[model samples]
Target: MAECLAIRSALSSALDLGIQFLSLKTDCQVLAKAISSKRTVVEVHGVISDIFFCISQLKGFTCSFILRAANVEVDTLAKAALASYLVIF
Candidate 1:
């Protein structure tokens, strides 16, 4: 979740620098569903709520849910990170 927030903030900052159209893609089904629903964010992720709200400000952005097989890079990286985290602590 923290990583998602950081990426969203960076993307927003980039978009601020004269972007015409932007589309966000995420493998997280929950996040994609939540944003597409255009409903208020729940308090569960209160710390990251601001970042989610910031996503609403982007123009022509669409959030999508992709299957694991279709998201090899992200899925691989997530698993690698999980493995590394476990190894570290």
Candidate 2:
């Protein structure tokens, strides 16, 4: 559920930036598959719907899953950012 919200947030940011073409890579396979298939489980249905709506506004987009090992850098960066936010708060 958090992963879906994260993807939605990223997509929303890209859209806000007027990005026409975007490729989203996620380490969460289930969320990736849900986005690709357009069939989401109950807990994420609303966010998935929002994501599909966002995708419709884009000229081109691709969502895929990567191995967590390959996503370490991004994970580290996100964690660091969150930690900084916590410290600031």
Q: Estimate each model's TM-score.
A: 0.58, 0.78
* lDDT digits (tens) for residues 1-89 of candidate 1: 53355445555676678664566566777767766775544643653465566665666666678876787777666566556556777
Instruction: Note the clash tally of each candidate.
Output: 0, 0
Task: State which candidate has the highest TM-score.
Answer: 2
**Cand. 2 TM to true fold:** 0.78
Best by lDDT: 2
Which ten residues in a row are the worst by lDDT in model 2?
Answer: 77-86
Which whole-number lDDT from 0 to 100 does residue 17 have in model 2?
99
Candidate 2 lDDT by residue in tens digits, 8-88: 777899999999898988888888888888776787788788999999999999889999899988666656655655677
